[model samples]
Target: MGLEFLDVFEQWANSYDESVGGQNREYKAVFAGYEQILEAVTERSMGHVMEFGVGTGNLTKKLLDKGLNVTGIEPSVPMRGIAEAKLGSKEIILDGDFLHFPDIINVNTIVSTYAFHHLTDKEKNEAIAKYGKLLSKGGRIVFADTMFESVEDYTNAIVKAREEGFHNLAKDLETEYYTTIPILRTILERSGFTVGFKRCNDFVWLMEGEKQ
Candidate 1:
């Protein structure tokens, strides 16, 4: 699935937290209100959660603190190690990605933050379809990630990043498969979910989809 970015994650493992904490100016806007975003995702999640891309276990910790049973899946070894260390021995983070994960049972809510855009639109569709089949009625998928309102907005964001001399941010925007709202809505609805979106920050939106 998103394993192609494994090396990136591996390299980022040590600095991921700092980057999200707004220590890095280039990504500050991207991770603006990081704590609040994680809280929003945690608030929406329900029983037996499956968390994809549990980098450093930040969101995973929030879910656990909310008294929710969580299964964390991370593809990067170093990221998983850091998460394991952070979450301690009680929690087990599995090896997986958006499309491929261990056969987890009773995962009524799926939660992820700032990570789903690693998948291309086609892969995103496949992942959503897989989740649709796996979840029962009333189950949910709550994700917060960078997405655009339109193609024009997407283009403008990259241009703005470039103008601000955030070449890394600009390149990331250009390289990754960041998609638009309409596309995500279509995918979620087609997969039999009633979905809604709320802006979390300038670069992130919280997408909540309930299985129908």
Candidate 2:
């Protein structure tokens, strides 16, 4: 679970939208083409969607607008509150993380954006395994997050962030649980998903995994 960052999310609740909108130069590249990334995730999702890390309900809104049934899960109280307020009383946004969500039914598609990296590689593997067991054949997982093509690329990204005087971005890169493509592919495949990745920007990539 990524609950260890609850305080960070609470603090970021108010400014998360602005930061993703490219207001924070240090994180601007990370969130480049923010709307398109959300749309990309939304476009891949269908039928009874369950969204993890629904921060501020941005992606939730898109899924809802697409006429998909969505249940949102957020670990941070303030973030959930903001998302609830934004999406209004009609939608259900629950308090949970990837591994600790309430039991949901008929969730054929799971979608998340810019949030899964909070989990360490081990946790990521566990989450994928859990989803593999929960989903039936043809169910899908669509996530857009900052992932590297390789460990060398991961290291280079941190170095570039540091060279650009993006100390916060560099520290975040080093501190968070960002992982490489091979590891994610291995985990998803081991868990029985046929997965694929598409670059969304310099930093983010869209990972779509269909359960087989």
For each candidate, the alpha-carbon lDDT, in order, equals 0.93, 0.93
Residue 1 of model 2: what lDDT? 74
Q: What is the per-residue lDDT of model 1 for residues 1-212, given as tens digits with 9 covering 90 to 100?
A: 77887888998999999999999999999999999999999999999999999999999999999999899998898999999999885356998899988999888999899899999999999999999999999999999999999999999999999999999999989988999999999999999999999998888999999999
Per-residue lDDT tens digits for candidate 2, residues 126-194, read 999999998899999999999999999999999999899999889889988999999999999999999
**Clashes by residue pair, model 1:** none
- Model 1, position 20, has a per-residue lDDT of 93
lDDT measured at residue 157 in model 2 versus the true structure, 0 to 100: 98
Model 1, residue 160: displacement in angstroms?
0.5
Q: lDDT value for candidate 2?
A: 0.93
RMSD of each candidate relative to the true structure = 0.8, 0.9
Write down the TM-score of every candidate: 0.98, 0.98
Off by over 4 Å in 2: none
